[model samples]
Target: MPETGDAAPDFTVPLANGDVDSFTLSERLEDEAPVVLAFFPGAFTGVCTDEMCTFQDRLAAFNDLDATVYGVSRDSPFALNEFRNQNGLEFGLLSDYNKDVIADYDIEMDFADLGVYGVAKRSVFVVNGDVEVTYAWVSDDPGVEPDYDEVEAAVEDAA
Candidate 1:
């Protein structure tokens, strides 16, 4: 997990929209806009779907705070497309299939015991214009999730 106050690593990952785009953490933070980068384990999973749909349902609240929300996962673009379309996602759900972004953010999972492939631990980062992580939450237990109220408070403060 990236430490708070550290500069976020930037990466360009594939998008479900059939375009390769890059998200520069610092660039997003410019003009004091807060960026909510939510990394999930995979697509179509129970928790992941609920997590993303929660964001979709409250997207306007985030927008009101001038925040741009991004959902990142290791799923392929096709899978991401389906997930977004099926759930009526209004934000970009990026494809980090290669795990490069996951590595850069130090969110990779260990597959030794479960025999699962590399997965991103569920996490969220609130970044400022200078690329500093103003707030961050990485789940110690993969089964758990970040506190939405805490995150919303952070977003409000950042705004």
Candidate 2:
């Protein structure tokens, strides 16, 4: 995945916005706002659900830091739409079903042996207003959660 001091790769995907509508990234996500890209293996999986809901619970913290968070996965937009509704997620759930974004970030975890393929590894990247990655964490295990304190500090610093 893109690391700190690296330029964040710009890619737009279908997003299930909190308004219960599908929108393009350019439609709502503020490019100038500090961005938290939360990439996970799948939408409904246990660890993925916890990680996403955790982000939702911390929404105000992100807002206080003037940051916007988006949960990204290779799930279809329709599935993401349902996931957002089911979780009451306040953020966008990006659909990278084509795996283009994951490919670009190079964070794909190989679960082919388990019959999963091209899923994004559990990871987070904090991007500043300049669209440069300020912090990055790619979990060694898919079941592991990210270091929230470190990511929050990065957002604060980038802000």
Prediction-by-prediction clash tally:
1, 0
- Candidate 2 residue-wise lDDT, 1-159, digit = tens: 788899888887877774334544333435546888899999889999999999999889998988889899998888888899999998888888889889989998879789988899999988776677889899869989998888888899988
Question: What CA RMSD would you report for each candidate?
Answer: 2.1, 2.1
Per-residue alpha-carbon lDDT of candidate 1 for residues 1-159, written as tens digits (9 for 90 to 100)? 678878778777776753446555555567646888899998888888999999888888888888888899999888888888888898888888899989998888865687877789999998766677878899856778778878888888876
RMSD of 1: 2.1
The candidate 2 region of ten consecutive residues with least summed lDDT is 19-28
Give me the candidate number with maximum TM-score. Answer: 2
> Model 1 off-target regions past 4 Å?
17-32, 111-114
lDDT for 6 in candidate 1 is: 83
Question: Which pairs clash inside model 1?
Answer: 29-129
Candidate 2 clashing pairs, residues 3+ apart or interchain: none
Task: Count backbone overlaps in model 2.
Answer: 0
Number of colliding residue pairs in model 1: 1
